[model samples]
Target: MSVIAVLALDGAPGHQLTAPGLAFATAARHHHPVAYEVRVCAGPGFAGTGGPAPFGIEAPWGMEGLDDADTVLLLGHEGFRAAPPPGVVDALLAAAARGARVGAVGTGTFTLAATGLLDGRRAATSRRHTRELARLYPRIEVDPEGAAVADGAFHSAAGVLGGVDLCLHLITLDHGDPVAIETERQLFLHLHAQAQDAGGAAPEDGPGAAEAAYNAVTPPGSSLEPVTRWMEANLHHPLTLDDIAGRARLGVRSLTRRFRAETGLTPLQYLLRTRIQHAQRLLERTDDPVERIAARSGLGTPANLRHHFQRSTGTSPTTYRTAFRALVSGITWPERPEQP
Candidate 1:
C-alpha cells in the first residue's frame, strides 16, 4: 500500500482537498483493501481550515507526517498572493527528491512551482491562475487544459473541479483502468469514465462531455457518437454543417437541427470545440511542429490554431503541449461505466 500525504495548506479549496482523499479512500474501501494510507498534514500551530467540508476537520499530523509519504497531494486555493510556508516547501521538495510522486490540485500548482521543482516540467492549474503562474515562473510549462497532468515526478490539475478528474486519473495510473471507471460510475461523473473509454468524448470539457458534478445524469443525447467521430476524422479539415452532416449520413439541415436540439450547440460551434480537442491532444501526445499540428487538427494554420486554442483554453498550444505531452502518451484514461 502506498502512503499518501495530503498537504493541508491554509486556505485550500474545500472540494480540492476532499476529492482525492475520497478517491483514495474509496479505492481502499473496495478494490485493493489497503490501497493507501492517507495523512492530512499541516504546519505547526495551524488552526483548522474552517471553510466548509474539510476546513473544520483537524489535521491528524504536522509537518512530520509528510516525512513518510510515498506520494504528496497538495490542495489548491485562490490565495496565490501567499506563498507556501518555507518549511512546507522544503519538505515537499525533499519528498520529490526522494522519488515520490508529487501531485498538486488546482491553484496548488502555485505552491509546487514556487519550489522550483517543476521548472521546465509540464504542470497544470486552474485557468484563472495560468497567466500568474507563468508570469512568476516563465519556464515551467503550465497547461490551462483541465486534465490532471503528470510528467516524471510532478503532477498538476486545472482547478478545484479538476481535482476529481486528477484523482480518477491517478487511480487508473496506480491501480488500473477498470477500477477507476467503476469508481467514476459510483461518483456519477461521466466525463472521466468516457475519457477512459477509447471512443469517449474529447478532453476539452466540451458541451456534451462536461457536466455539473459526477452524477448518473442522463446523457445529453446519442448525437455525441456521430459528432465526436466526425470531429476526430475532420479536425484539420474546414468543417461545416454540410460536412459533418454528410459524414454522419444526414442532411445538413437535419444534422444541424438535431445536433443543436440535443447538445444545445450549433454544428459549427460543436465542430470548433471538437477541433480544439484534437489540437490539444495532438499538442499533448506528439512533437509535431505548430503548423503541422494546426494542419493535422484542421485548425488551418499555426496562427489560427493559436488564436482558437488560446480563446478556448487560455494558453498557447505549444505551452500546453510541452507540459502535457507526458501525460496522455500511451495513456488510456478511464471512462464512465456503461448504463445498465
Candidate 2:
C-alpha cells in the first residue's frame, strides 16, 4: 500500500483535511488492490477552521510522519500569509528530495513556496489571492484560471473544489481511467445523498430540479450530462455530429441548439476541446509518441494534433512534453498495484 501524509497546520480548512482521505479511500474501496494509507500529520500549533467555534485538531501523526511517505500533501492554513511553522519547510524539502510527490491545496501553495521548491514552477491558488501570491513570489508562474497544476512531482490547486480535482488527478495517475471514473461516480453519489438530506428535491421531481442540484455540485453542462459523459467515454473514436446526436436521441439541429445553450459551444467545438484535453493528459502522463497520442485522442495524426495543440495551448506537443518531463527526470514514481 502507498502512504499519503497530509500535513495539517494551524487553521487548516476542514474540507481540505478530509477531502484527500475521502477521495483515496473511495478509490481503494471501489478498485481492487488500490490501497492507500493516509496519515494526517499535524504541524505545530494545529487547529481546524470553519465552524461556530475554532477547535484543536489532534492528528494521529506528527512531522516525522512525512519521512517515509509516498506523497505529502499540505493543507492551506491561516498562517499562510506569514512564514510556515519552523521545520515545516525543511520537512517538505526532505520529502521531495527523497522522491516523494508533493501537493498543496488552496493557500497551501504559500507554505510550499516557502520551501523554495516552487520558485520556478507554475502553481494555482484561489482567485482572490492570485495577485498577492504573484506579487510575493515573482519567480513562480501563477495561473489565475487553472483549477489544478501538476508540474513534475509538485502539484497545487485553487479554490474549494480544486482539492477534489487534485486528489482525483493523483488517483488517475496512480491507477488508470476505470478506477478514477468509479471513484468519481462514488463521490458524486455521496454528494447527491448529502443534497437530498439537506432537503434538496430529488431528480424524480423534474428535469429542472435535477439539473439545478447537479450544477450546484458539479461544473456546468448538467443539462446534457448523459451526452457529455458519452462524448468523453468515446473520445478515442472519430465521432461525428450525427453519431453524437443519435446517441442523444435528438435530431442534429436540436442537439446543436441544446449544446450551444447549455455549454456555450457548438457540438463540434466541444468535441474538439475534449480531444485537445485528452491529448494533453496523454502528453503529461505517458511516454506515447505523438502519432499514437493523436490516434487515442481522436486527432488522427501527428500533424493534426500538432496543428490543433499549438493553436489551443500555444505550444508544440514536443516542447510541452520536454518541459513537463524535465523536472521529473530523476524522480521515482510509486509502484503500481498488481492487476488482478
Candidate 3:
C-alpha cells in the first residue's frame, strides 16, 4: 500500500521510467503482495524524453502526486544537466522532509543532487557521465561505476538497464530475498540479477568486482575488507569455508550472518558466483581453453565449470563466449580446437 511517485521530467529514459512500475506490476501479478502503488506523474505540459527510448507520455498526476508518495523516484531526461523545473526541487525537499525515500536513475541524480539531498553522499550514474557528474557536483561523492548503490534510504544507479538491478535491490530491501527473487523471476530477469561479488560490481554491467565494490556499500573501512580482498585474490585456489572464516578472523557462523546482511548472499554463494563470473570474463575476453579457465576460476574442472555455468547463465561456456564477443566486439569468433 506504499504510494510510489515516478516523476518523469522532460525527456526521461524509457526503461528508468517504466522499470520500477513493471517490476511492481509483475510483483502483484505473481501474488507477491504488491506493496507499492505506483503512479507515473509529470508536471503539466511535460516535454517528452529524447535519448535512447524516445516517446511521449501523458500521466494523471502532477507535482501534487508527490505529496502522499512513500517514495519519489526521479527519472532522467534530455536536459538532465539543466536546473530542475520550478517547484520541482521544493516539492522533492518537502517529500524528503516527510521521510519519503527519494530515488534517482541516471541523470536524475543531477536533479536529486540539485535538491541537496545527495550532498556528501555517493551517487551513481552512467559511467559515461561520471566525469560530468563529479565536475558539476563536487560536494557529492560520485561512484561512476556502481551498478547500483544503497546508502541509508537513498539509492542511485548508472543506466536504464541498471534500473532493474536498482528496483530488485529495493524490492529485496522492502520485502525479503524470496519475494524479490520471485518478482524478478516473474519479470524474466534471472540472467541479469547481478546480486553481489563481495566487490560490489554487477556482472553484466560496470567492470568486474576487481575493484572495491562490496566495501563501497559497507560502512567506511569495513572489517570485512581484508577477508573479501583475500578471497578475491585467491579465487584460483580451492578455498574452504574454514579458510574464509580464518581469513576474516571470525567463526563460520558469524561469517555467514555477515555475508547475508551485507551482500544478500552467503560467503560461499558469493564466491561461487564470483568464480563463475570470472570464468565468464575469461571466456568472453580470452582464447584460453576451458580446462585452464575452469582451473583458474576455481571451478576445479571443465565438467564442474560447465554444470554451474549452464545453471547460472543458461548457456554453455562456448556459446556464452561467442555471443558475448560478437555482441561487444561486432565480430563473431568460431570455436578454436581445444588445447590438449
- The clash numbers for all candidates, in the given order, read 18, 0, 6
Whole-model Cα lDDT of every candidate shown, in order: 0.66, 0.75, 0.71
Please write out the lDDT profile of model 2 over residues 81-165, one tens digit for every residue: 8988999988998999999999998889988988899988999876677898999999999999747798989998774542777
lDDT of 1 by residue, 173-246 (tens): 77666457546533532333344455553345322233211111112235556555657665666777666777
TM-score of each candidate structure, all chains considered together: 0.53, 0.59, 0.56
Using TM-score as the measure, the top candidate is 2
All candidates in order of lDDT, best leading: 2, 3, 1
lDDT of 1 at 28: 53
Model 2 has how many clashing residue pairs?
Answer: 0
Candidate order by TM-score, decreasing, is 2, 3, 1
As for candidate 2, its clashing pairs are none
lDDT of 3 by residue, 112-136 (tens): 8898888888899766678888999
Which portions of model 2 miss their true places by more than 4 Å?
50-53, 200-340
- Of the two candidates 2 and 3, the one with more favorable TM-score, higher being better, is 2
The predictions' CA RMSDs to the true structure, in order, are 17.3, 17.7, 11.9
Q: Which residue runs does candidate 3 get wrong by more than 4 Å?
A: 189-340
